[model samples]
Target: MVIAAFENEKNLPLNELMIPLDEDGIERSVPALNEKWKDSRIFTRYTSFPFRANTTLVEEGAALEQWFSETGWFVKDMEWLLGLEHYRFWSTLVYNRGAIESVVSFTQSAVPYYLAGAARSSPSVFPLYSAAHRATLQVICRMITQRESDRCWIGKEFLGELLYKHYLVSIPLLFDLLPVYGRDNKQVLTLMVQTIFKLQPKYGQDLKVGLKFLQSTFKTIQQQIVTDRLDGNIASLTRLNDLAIYTLDCSTVLALLVECYPDCRSICTELAMEQSITNFYDNTIVVLYKNIHAMDNESTYLTYLNTARMELLSAFRGIVNFQLETVLDNPQRSLIPADKFLCTLTECLSDPVFVKDYQRHYPVEQDLDVLRQACRSVDTFKMDFVQNAYCLEDGANGLSNGYVEPLPEDDESFGEAAGGVAEDELAEAGPSTASGPVLTPEQQIEANVQKVLDVLPHLGDGYVRKILSRYDDVEQAIAAVLEGNLPPDLANADPTEPYIPADKLDTLFVETGIERLNIYDGDEFDVLVHDQIKGVMKKGKGMPGQPKNLKEMLDDKSHVREMKGRYQEYTNVCDEYDDEYDDSFDAMADSESKTVRLTAAMRNALVDELEDDDEDDAEVEEDVGQSGGKKTLDFCENPEVVRQRYEESRRSKFQARQGGFVPPGGGSGKDVVGKAKGQGQDKSVLLNRKQKGEHKSSRANHNRKQGATFKRNKGMIPS
Candidate 1:
């Protein structure tokens, strides 16, 4: 039926779309799709709706929106809607679920274009009509609850994408819708709270910022409540009543109030009259418990609630028990059995029925031990005694009535005195013990006040400050307000109103020795940072002006010294680089001596190697000639003699090149005179031979003289 309705609205063929069915739909026009959808059992386990199908559906809506606008069907509706308040659609959608989604999707989709149009306007005007917008909100809300049974999740991006584009202008407008639509729409309230809870899992601090914004809107809602009541607007009142009921979702609104602002109780109390405020809190708790019960199958939600409940109970117990403890401490004061209240709860908590039910419903074990211990303590207190205490029937003494033993009557008053009193009877009837002392109300109050002082710091800074300031002027204000000791004008004065006039504060600044805090024109106060630092300083121990320990002082000195050393090292590196630049300048001026010597040495080595190669080639030529002319001579007859002749020939040829004079074999310059001078002394050749020939020729001559003593040298002419 739903699929058919959707198809009929879109004018689409039913054959293309697969529709899931229950056993009931038999005579439907596209029965095969329904049959297939059902037989497939796909509905039971959908992670996300198929994207192709979703896109097709969205395209159908786009076509529908376009067709309606072009054909002037909704043009009239649009014109009409444009003129009504933003909430007009919200109201309309509350009655009709089919139209709810279309309107929400349309508004969310159209917001950007509207904003764009607004921006282009001479003086920007929002395109949204408030009434129609609100009506659309109601429609969306109706859809959320109606569709919840199907578990048809609306992806968060559907809202996020719209908000992302138009947040600057539309966020405040979105906030306005909450006040208008949230009051009666429980489903919408739950959806929003759940969404916030999802976000809070990751970005709690950001969620707090969002919560603060939402909380401020509650103020406007309070004003609207008053306005509607005074104007006798029944429609508005009914809407507001619906909104208020919906606002009870896990007391999310109340939780936000407490979280965003500390004085939320007083604000909410004032908004809800004195009598109804308590009912509001009770209703909120009912909503919380209902949600808790709803998640019985899952342990997570139960655990969260159980943990939270335990924390609250523990804190309350701590406050009450401490009061009892203090009352008992005073010798004059009697203890008020405040512990009885929790004792009963503790006993109930330990009962298998309560524990099993609590565990089944809400299964968080955050501080179960503490909760169990509390229960155990209460269990030790007799149930009957607890009931009597709750009834306030138990007096200072354990006796039923507040009674004391009558003093013993004197024997002289009686005409006949007792002959004998039995010793055993006297002993048995002697003053039996009475119960412990009971505290007076005044002492109880004092003990409670002391407990409150101890609990103050835990409540947060804003709460502490507000509480401290509330009764600062009690002496003057109380007598005037309560006792009628002062004028009626003073009696009705607002406590929050400043005691000193603003003008007087300025005058007093000059009159007293105290100087008003001077803030420079350019300076901005960092109150948050200042508060953080003040908190740190406040927690510090010892005399305020006292010096640190010797170790701390020495460590501080070391730290300073370490930093100075690092800085000096950095400066030294910088100075070294500067010195390097100066050295480079001096190096440029005295560069020629080393460059000239190095060039000459390189040239000489190249020339000498070339000359040595030539001498070796010449010797090879001479040996070849001698070998050709050999007449069956044995070259190895005297090996050392041949070696000495070879050495002499090499020395004689090498000496004639290079500019230096060389001896042939035995005398100075003898080798040059005998075999090398003039015949090979070309100046260019001498330059080429200098490095290779000089050392080889001198060493060769020294060897040839030694060879002559061993054998007659054939290659060397006597020199």
Candidate 2:
């Protein structure tokens, strides 16, 4: 029969004949068990028409047919299989590499395609439908693979296309097929829902169609509840988490739809207000809470609820919040008309009930005395742990290595000890001051550090071991002496000194414990500063320095939190601006000249910023002569100089602004049109540098044309 089907076809390849041809005269490469049958009268007669009214699918089918004719779909072909598999493989790699949200959507879309062959109508309809499903999957996989998270504008454009063409019609149609394959195919069905949701999040109206399908699902469940009650088939009649998921999905769909189509709120409001449905949702929440508290006994029954708890909570929370805002406070003016419903939802969220549920997980501490004791214990533990592992004498590294030095001891105590060292050391060394070319202060510090290292071995094994074990002591010592001058005799001492006077060192250490704080590690600080510079280069604020003044901290939280927040906000703003700029770029990419000009300008600006600290302040003044004249008057005041510079630049740009003029490629409508026109014409037709010489020679002729145009325009004036 396969041979017979192929024999009737004009295309010579039997493989090509097995695949259905789309209406566009191209071979459909997708696998089909009944290619001949789908084209025949039996299947199309019933399922064709109003059910398949989407023009986009029709056009896509034509395009698919043409593509398939070029490359046949061979299931056994390794290359072909790999090509299809590439989408998922790349998406997984990207997901693992920290591309979070988009990968979730991409992976979800593949689920339905995997189930297509299984979800068919008998043997007759399975082949053609499966083939079409596979084709759709291929396109989906390709689209997902190509989509980068950074391409937000491209996503918007694609979404507009999908909405306009109604490419979204396939989603709900595909979702409807899930149940037909049976409950055993639950994984596939779940995946399908997740994928559809992810891909179509922007298309809130399209999602409404899927939500409508789910609403019907609810009706079916309600019917089953009544039927089971009457027929003694009832197990537990309460709504499960799966029902909640469907409800949440519907709500999410409806929420977005409400933004696009506010009327959906009215329908949902009416349905939710109905006493029976409200009772059902309330009962569902109770069941959900019960399952959360006691899922061990009823594992199978609560499985769906347990798996979808987070989603259910989100939906309920949103619904409750929405109801509270729209209906609770302003009952008379409420558009939803479900005051009681809103009240119930609010009570469910607010009460001792919700609080109790959370408290089960995170119990609140009420006794202040006990809390104080507990906090002290925790602080003691932290101090002990850090001290043991990271004492200044132990030479511990910084936080990245899981160590923090103990706070410095008193400087007054250390000062007394240093005095003893100075006297004792001077008596032994015989006033070691230099007469010829004295050692520098830095040289003296290096000499002292070297002397410490040399004596470290001989300073008793325990002492040597403690100092060697911890780098924190060195950090503390450096911080302590950074401000104070060392003795001239010690500074004049040789770089390599013996281990004789360990007693004097204890004096120096005691005197130097003046609340030592490490400001920045030379290399580590640069890394932080570099990141801040990058933020500034991206036109975002640099991270704030530590808060010494109350005024700065009063801007927000504490010094630490405020600085961290500024860093985060800077990164976030850059991210947002990048998205906007990329969108602007993509919008202009098709217009070649504008993209080139805009890209060059952006690059030039970035380069200038990198090279010049005050590039932003370097806008040249229009009246340099006028500004130069003012320089005789006191220009020494920093504020006055800055203000004058700003004023000068404003004056310079003013004439251009007043003439209704804009710089070339300055993001204006006229500029875009001009650039687009310029890009469209061939470069050879445009005047080049070589042609410009001849054009300049003909300036008189050009002037004559301009003069004639001006004369003609002058004649057109009414005066």
Candidate 3:
């Protein structure tokens, strides 16, 4: 049936092809397979049968390859088979093994092709691909689990080859398969962890994929730890720390991966906080410090440093508590080199470079206090431990007598002690003592005063002087500071000049000639100045009537309208005079005779007089017009007599002008208008006179009694 299936490869069902097995269900010998099968034509035809068609065929094939291993036929022919671009065939080979060496060798040799096929496989055929993936993972896991103790190293070597060569392809496969493998499968989990550790030292693009795979594996471990409540897994912790240290070594890769994947940071943080793992805490601190140092973002650096600091504190507390417990439990073993640990921790916490960098970025007080406390605790512990250790060492050395022979003066120890004392003195003296003579008390005081003088510019000179005078001694200074006493100058300062009271603020504005303070009473001024004043004034203590000021009185819309109206009236009067003056001046300048010319000042005087006369005439006309014909008998005898007198006076003036006789008032028409011919009295004056005469005539006519008669008189005429 197998031969027939191969003969009709295109026609027969691929599943029907299977290797012939004996009654025991083991693969039968394949003696018939020989040199002829090694040829390309026969090999390709034989290997074309699908390996997944039957499990027996895969096992039988491996047996056949083993049967011909001496002739090197399988090795020569399997190369062509592996090159056939068959995922199922390779998966089958992975599923069924002949020799460990042959299987591992074949798998390693075919990893690149498998990865390429997996990469090229379509999503539609993902089920088939997943089956192949499962088979591959099971094969690797089996090889690792089934290996002998002496040959277990081969498993790691094989995994390294697979991972380092095919990291990109393996990453997705591992991620997809990790959850499927589950934490229940300890062997597989161990193999996965071992595979990650092997890939740690690798560099290049593959290292990043390896890191992602490791991160995913850590997440799996984390979940398992949570699910199983495995608080302390030393092996897992060690592996995690190893991975972190490896990542730290490749800082650029770690930074890129952590930045791209925030979970990487969480994974690292978890690994660092794993107290079960040896040196995990310290490793985490170093890694976090390195990451913070490398990071440029202030916020990210602060976040990392804070986490590290918390972990450091926890670690310190644990170490101290553990040491104390150890001492309580076994005094002899209590000497746990805690002083060294404390010293190392102290050095790390007090790293001047880190302190400078940290302060440069986030100079918060609480964070600073945290570091100081850590250092102080370490210092106190170290001091106590040193004293205890010294007494213990002396007691152990049988020096409890308290009387010992001193080393000879010229002995190396004595000389070294002397030198150390000298160095200590020099260190305590400081750089200034080394560079210059020490200052006396007076000189030190003078220096302090000079420093105060330097700062006096910022604090006003008067204020600083007053403070100095009040706090003459340390006790007074302390009392003054405690009481929050102000300087004498400020304490005695007048309040009125500093801030204008609300009610009187408007007076200030008025004095400044500002008629409209309300125009400035908007949010713009409030933002620029008012808000600041309010802040300084404090709540409930504002300048009496602040904010409202004179806005209510000055900003009244009705008052604004009245002022506008008055301004408009004044402008109209001025414009009217301007026009009249301009016209009069032009007329005078155009006259031919120099006698009629008027200087600018004279012209202005004439314009003013004319304006006054026009106003008076208008007033008089208004009164007479409103009164109508009603008049007191004493004020006016009769309207007809009054009209006759006005007509006689006008006739006499006209006759006088014709005869070249100046009026008794010494006024002439020529002086008012011009002496030139064709020019009569000023048109404006003439118009005014005409209007008045017409008004009078109309009034007289309206009041006339038709039957009444009157006699002409010197001052009156009858009508």
Candidate 4:
């Protein structure tokens, strides 16, 4: 207190009297505690003197702006074990050089060292290299998604910083060649991809960037292969094998996309809009065919050739199935004369290796038989063409069907991520004979029951049936039963029936809609596509909310809205033109009266309030004079606070703090105004200061970051 009193620089914006001056005091003079000075933990604690990076400079400078993001009140003790409050923690990240950019620079620099031939061969270097690599990925993920919880994934507004500012978090950064992101760490790779997915709709100009990259990647292979492996020079074909690793990453991205948007038309709409995706499917299939016959059966470049082959085939099949199943408007949808699906396979027929592998792992014969059965009733296509497609029946053009070497058995799901009913579910529903009768919903319930049993066979049939009856979906019911998590349903009723449909009529009173009943053959096609689905997917624009961390919650932008309100008071001023150049008084200087005047209503209200308590003689005094030159308070923008003051003012003994009373029988003591305005130094300051900043909080508007004391934070923290 004595030191503060002696300080003559009290009026300065960033005066250091007692507490640490800005961040300069962070440079502790104590030799014994030098280590503590470097530690960021020192600042998070409450301190009398604290500061923040100047937001104006950050917003204006193009170079510095890219390295750092706009800091908010999110940094705190909980996120980092150190007990630093938001202001201290945020300043720590931005004050010294830059943390985010530094990490990026380090990662970029170390990539070459790790990729060097010596580092690659050295057993000792691998662990260090691997740890460093994973750490870099973790840092990238952390920076992009600051909030660790699920509820608020990557903040929507912060996404702007990621796209326009930080160049590290990009699609090419992860999905490019081995030199860029060498080791195939599935978890780390998935995290990077998820970051892109979350950033999408906004993140890199997003989905399109990733899509274009994948499109080019697939196109590259198709371009390299000149119709056949032999046509391309042997060297070029061998070079195609180099892309084996790259395609594996690309295939993962496509598989995730398929899983995210289960509907083929839906994803196609996102990638190419209403345009036919036949070419898109062909690009992938062409890449697969290239990989199948590329000079070598296996390459050191691609460790998981089998996995890649299966993925490529799976992604291609999904795309083809979508084009075939959807009631597309394109003329190519009519496969009556020529099957484009078989054409993609025709090139493969020449290669016996692919034929045997395809037959063994994922048989073409079975898939074709299923297609024939599905198209049996629909009149959309000529079943004869599909039936006559001999690509499945024959040795497939010169290739021999006799298996020379058997491929490994399929362990993973043998279908697209979002494929038809499971085997267990179908079995319980009972086999469908050629002349079998239609099954009731109860029979469908039986199918779901068996599906649950296949996974959790320990549970009794009755329990699975009850669960299936409660929740119509197989996955949902099984999940609920395993986790024992249930949400309250208002229309709860225990049904005696084994199965229940979600949209079906529970009682006769509820009328069944035609769409729901679907008396017409449910071909799962023919629905009108409102628009050619185009453009990258955006949030709340038909993009599915993917399952994220269990703890994730929706981001609350209320604070953002609140801060936005405060800045609106001076948005135009930042643009230029002298904001203080008010000319309202230019013409009124001579005509305007010097004396402040009140309206008739104000004078009348004042007189009435100043009247003596004698009810019989309630006549207000005439010529109610203005008291002690007290000015009327400016309007407060806060509706809630104004309402509160208005309520308090109407109290019988209402007494204001700022308004001085007029002499006897004049205006009432103190003002009865709904709200008081002032600079708001403190609660006591309210008695004297008028015209309070309506947007400022009670305690030093944002720690004076925007107050009269605002200054640059660079010099404050010691270098």
TM-score of every candidate: 0.22, 0.23, 0.19, 0.32
lDDT of each: 0.37, 0.38, 0.39, 0.43
**Model 1, stretches more than 4 Å misplaced?**
1-134, 145-179, 191-477, 481-719
The candidate maximizing lDDT is 4
Question: Distance (Å) between predicted and true CA of 344, model 2?
Answer: 5.5
Model 4 lDDT-worst window of ten: 47-56
Task: Summarize candidate 4's per-residue lDDT along 488-548 as a digit string, tens digits.
Answer: 5412433223333553323322543334444322333313222334344455534465435
In angstroms, give how far residue 304 of model 3 lies from its true place.
Answer: 5.9
Task: List the candidate 3 regions with Cα displacement exceeding 4 Å.
Answer: 1-343, 346-719
**Candidate scoring better on TM-score of 2 and 4:** 4
lDDT of 1 at 78: 36
lDDT value, residue 254 of candidate 1: 37
Q: Rank the candidates by lDDT, best first.
A: 4, 3, 2, 1
Per-residue lDDT for 1-719 in model 1, tens only?
34332322333222232233334665444422232322111111001111121112122345444433432432334344334322232223333333333343344333221122222231211222233344455433433321222222233443333223323113233333333344344456546545443422333343345545544543444455456547975433234333433343223333432332332233332232212222322223223433333333232333333333332222223323343443345423322233433442344432222222233333323223333333343343444333332222212211111111222233222212444544454455553311212348654434333333232212232332333334444244333334556444433544334222245336545655444455521123324223333322333565554445777655565568779977887665433357787898888877744643457888899899999999888877787788886346565679898799987776655565533455434443322223265565655545445644666566657576677855555655564
Comparison by lDDT, 2 against 3, better one: 3
lDDT tens digits, residues 276-391, model 2?
Answer: 23333434444443443333333343333332333333333344444445544554554342333324433343233232332233222221223233233223343333232222
**Sort by TM-score, top down from the best:** 4, 2, 1, 3
lDDT by residue (1-719, candidate 3, tens digit) is 12211232333222222223243455453322122123223221111111221111222355434433422443443443344322233233333333223323333322121123332333433343343334445545543332333312223454455444533224443333333332224365545544454444453344355655554543443354344334553334334333433332222223323333333333443333223221322333333333333332232333323433433333333433333343445544434433433343344332332322222333323322333344433345455433332222111211111112211132233435545435455557787543334569755444433334332212333344345556665445435534767666656753122222245446645655544445444334444335553433335634655555467647656768779977887665443346788888889887845667899999999999999899889877786789885433466488997888886777577667654434444433433333466666666556656665677556456445421333233335643
